[model samples]
Target: MSENHTSTASTPSAPRKKHRNLAQGVVADISEQIQNEILKPGDKLPTESEIMRIQGVSRTVVREAISHMQAAKLVETRHGIGTFVLEPPPAQAFGIDPDTVITMRDVLAILELRISLETEAAYLAASRRNEQQLQELRAALDALLNHTPEDGDAISPDVHFHLLIAQTSGNRYFYDILHQLGTNIIPRSRINAAKMTHDDPAAYLERVNHEHEDIFNAILREDPEAARAAMRTHLSNSRERLRRIQESNEIKSSSDNTRQ
Candidate 1:
């Protein structure tokens, strides 16, 4: 009788790894072109061969790059129609829009919107929060205390704390909207906060902490009006900072225009 021995080595497959920057470059370059209007919405991009030639890269590289752009919703590729630029939908339309513009005015507008929606949200949350919600809020506060920097650094517990409050509000939609806004809100808030209170770290944090304490106290008391007032004060501070930044930027731009 003849017996055959099989080895696992012959069938072993190598783990696949992604190329970190090449694909990123492709996506970023294409997205920038779209945002700059070089590639408008509905404008079809060149074929794979054309891109490979222009980028001086392999077909695999081109494909991988295009895939990233598609995933970011910056472009769409049809089966036989090739890829076309995608229009940026409104904020909160879906996932991150690659074409979204970042400016001081834009940041200020977003802050204003948050002031209106989130104040009402806090009011409702104060009335509706249960013991579990209160516990979550306290936990978030603990995390903030642990993470808040004594000196000026980039660390922020703001996003997670607000997210916790939104979840504790008992409205799934509030959580969803908060999640969507998370990406856009944080950077803007950080900029505004930093610009507003760059003078004194201790003072800034004390003021912010007091605002938080007032809001939490209202929630504990189940006083919707007080909760709303606290949130309004917190967001108003943000808006005031953004206004200063916008004014500064406009002045700088005007000076540059004259110098030119």
Candidate 2:
């Protein structure tokens, strides 16, 4: 009997992985096109049939991939209006961060910027807030009426309170800016506040409540200068606390990465 040797070729199963990969690739391609402004906001995405034709994928795969992007807030689907890009990509939900690299000084600078905007916001809020706005502001404050330092609440209420003030300033632009920046600012401020409160509960609470009361009084009196000043003092304390935090983080990061 003669020895026989056989060589087998790879089967169609190898391409199965490629199919799933191709589906993901299609999703990414669509997302990039939209983000690049090649597909403008409010422009309807191509229909399912059209996408299938363009991507050379089956109907089910195309729909599944598009469904994933919609869930990610990158796109929205209307019953009859078709899929369109959401406006401004929802605050904190999307952005390109060129300035994500942070230094101790940069952190302090952000806090300083907050001081300027918020103080003016308080001043304008005092004289400009209308009945509805006041009601909303009070509602927001009431959400934190008795918040204790130990109680880990008031985060959302605090944010809404500031947003109300910004809106009441009668500058939609200010409101939008605050809405965008607030997402980043509030949590950092809260973390810094928690650290300070943990260190000296009584003093921290006393100072915070007193400054808040002063801001409230200024708003009630409609004294723009006092409102601004009170807000400045409040934000200044916050700025100092964050600066301390940045220094601490720098020290910690330095120690961790130190070579033995």
Candidate 2 is scored at a TM of 0.54
Query: Model 1, which residues run further than 4 Å from truth?
Result: 1-99, 150-156, 188-192, 195-197
Question: How many pairs of residues collide in model 2?
Answer: 0
- Would you list the C-alpha lDDT of every candidate in the order shown? 0.73, 0.73
Q: What digit string (tens of lDDT, one per residue) describes model 2 on residues 97-191?
A: 42562555665666676688888889998988667776776666666566776786546666777788888888786677777566665444455
Error of 1 at 59 (Å): 48
Q: Once model 1 is optimally superposed onto the true structure by TM-score, how far is the C-alpha of residue 215 displaced, in angstroms?
A: 1.2
TM for every model, in the order presented, reads: 0.57, 0.54
